[model samples]
Target: MRKRLFILGLLLIGIFLFIWINNKWIVVSEYTINSSDMPAAFDGVRIVHLSDLQRTSFGKKQLPVLEKVAAAEPDAIFITGDLVDADRFKLEPVLTLLNGLSEISDVYFVTGNQEISKDRAEEVLSALKRTEITILENEKAKWNREGETVYIAGIHDPLMDISTYDPLIDVNFRNQEIEYSKRARDYTRESLEEVPFTDDFTFLLTHRPEMIEEYAETPADLVFAGHAHGGQIRIPGIGGLFAPGQGFFPELTEGVHEFGDIRLVITRGLGNSSFPLRINNRPEVTVVTLEHEEVTGLNK
Candidate 1:
């Protein structure tokens, strides 16, 4: 009996350790985006992408995330929303992260459902405006390099449409989601229309990877998104078990997905919401490097 109890204790300890590591461990995902349309001046431009912080802090004042971004030497950093969790909203963690990141490189951001759903959403937005981070709301910003330009456009999360009410418990929640998704797509299309279509590469930053279809309809060369939280729990070869928007066995949980000529990069994100812990899926930070490929002769 004594031996059996001892073994059970060991097993419980092991389980606890596993859960802690999975939730706290941070991993870096690296990718190279090759595009024939990439301007020569922007080639090798490294971008550090972060998302869905959800009020999770790594180390003191987000030292772990900051150190990783600084090490990557990014030309720019893009955060695709959820800096704070609506359920347990706080501003310090979000501000700490944004302040640290701004020191490293120019930071750009777009909102996620969490930001829109929070009661104090306006406070969060106001604080962000005071910082160096540029908040893109249905608009575009230009980055110039050696006389060449790349456009970075961002759209508001679909949740903004229903910010005044609680959509989660509504009798028509599913129908509302469907309708909001379409609205989100239209918002993307309309926002892009305002950009005066150009040949230079364009990057779209959004919070929901599930909206890839809507984003693909635009002329963006690449899209960065979060909010799936790696399905909240990954299953090795099987992928994520469930994501808020994608539901069970979601297809767009993480990694790179392609839609026609456009590519989308989804970050698993650094924090957790709704679900308390992450299983098998560690918090993720993504680094993407742009490679310009020349189209020669007949292709040109």
Candidate 2:
């Protein structure tokens, strides 16, 4: 009887482990939304959005997971925030991986709370200087793909220090730093303000999903974010268990939510945080396809 009980316990444990890994990997949840702003030339363009990858939390298995995503062959790749593991984990290999992804699709990056340069500001600055990836800081990149030109706007995580200057204030004129979110928005807004009003479509890249409420009122057709980590553990019906910002349950925890005239998508990301990992909330990448239309109610 004792032996039988022990064997049953072991079986249960194995089953639980299997379930967890399957949820963590294997299951890649996808989100697809329609943007009336998409140009006719690139109507079905597929974009893969990745977020909240705390490198320290994920194991060796993550690389193969990422490679699988690359195989999907997305036209554009957008990374929202927290790529580095709270400024400690070596981001070199991650950078190298991103560099390789450049061959697959045009990749873009934005900042996150973890990307904040509060601790080693100088170090982060020096490293970003070497990357070929377009780190959108309150700027817009115009792409002429599929015989149509479209605009993609990028905003760094609102909880970080975004400075165009590196080693500029040698006088130690610190303490003038503004709220991270405000800084991110002002700069990103400045970037998109210059885009032609008639551009094919404009999508925003922001790290914190909290900014969606404000950005939705803007001209953006859709805004993407991923800082919540899907509350690390989601509860049924009630949705995300607990989100950091906005208190209680955040509206933009995961999946899709609509703001005034824009759509918002919050990715669960590809790694873990807070509790070091997730439960039912599997890490994922979103492939958003845009379509053109002569329709109204663009939420603009």
Candidate 3:
């Protein structure tokens, strides 16, 4: 009986280990976003969205991750945020991944919670600029193909203020920081105020998905976000169990969510943070192909 019980225990441990290792493996999730606002010249254009990598590396020099991205043939690459792990002192892994990715295509970046947290702000920003990756913070970039243009814009995470230049700040400081979500909206609105509303299809890049409600009201046609980490753990039928900004069973945890004409695509993210592993959730790199819809019937 003792021998049998010991064997069973070992088997159980093996099974758990298998599940944990497999879950940590990276996976690519592809999505096609069709919009009538998309210019005809932009059809079939691929934009790879990577978010919340948090300094995780896949193979030496991030070869595996880069291989997958290069295979997709992305016309542009958008890294939403959290390229570095918050607790990590070494940024080589993050820089290695960035340098590898930049070789593949145009790499755009924005701030995440980790990038701004605990005295890492300047270091993170400086490294990104040094790599020559375009930093889109409350700004827009125009991508022209065949004489048609699309705009890509990005915003700084609200935590950019909370985590910078203050190590002694308390929980109340965080609460005060979150309040800046409103300010983020105002900034975006003001920035785009001069640009005509129908000028082009504006894609907004933000770190936090929880601010989707506010972003929906902006002039942005689409928003890309990643900060939930797929709620840390997702259950089959029940969906994401919990997320930092959205709380338990958060509604905006992952996938594409729409509010009227404004669409928000939230990536499950590329790596982990506080939690060491995810159960049903695997690391993700979202590839979005933009398709143009022809106006017909009353729309014409």
Q: Estimate the lDDT of model 2.
A: 0.68
lDDT, candidate 2, 187-259, per-residue tens: 5555445444433477788887776555765677778888887776777777776665545666667788876
C-alpha lDDT of residue 277 in model 3: 73
- Model 1, range 1-300, lDDT digits (tens) per residue? 999999999999999999988988889999999998889999999999999999687888889889989999999999999999998888898998899999999999998889888566687789999999999987889999999999998887766765665567678887877776667666656665655546669999999898787778778899999999998888878999999767899999888888899999999999999888999999999999999998989987
Q: Where in model 2 is the C-alpha error above 4 Å?
A: 4-12, 15-23, 56-62, 161-200, 294-300
Give lDDT for model 3.
0.81
- TM-scores of the candidates are 0.93, 0.79, 0.88
Residue pairs in clash, model 1? none
Global lDDT scores for all candidate models: 0.87, 0.68, 0.81
TM-score of 1: 0.93
Could you give candidate 3's per-residue lDDT for residues 113-183 as a string of tens digits? 88988777888898888895899876788988999898888878766644433424556776654565555
Higher-lDDT candidate of 2 and 3: 3
Between the candidate structures 1 and 2, which one is better when assessed by TM-score? 1
Residue 156, model 3, lDDT: 81
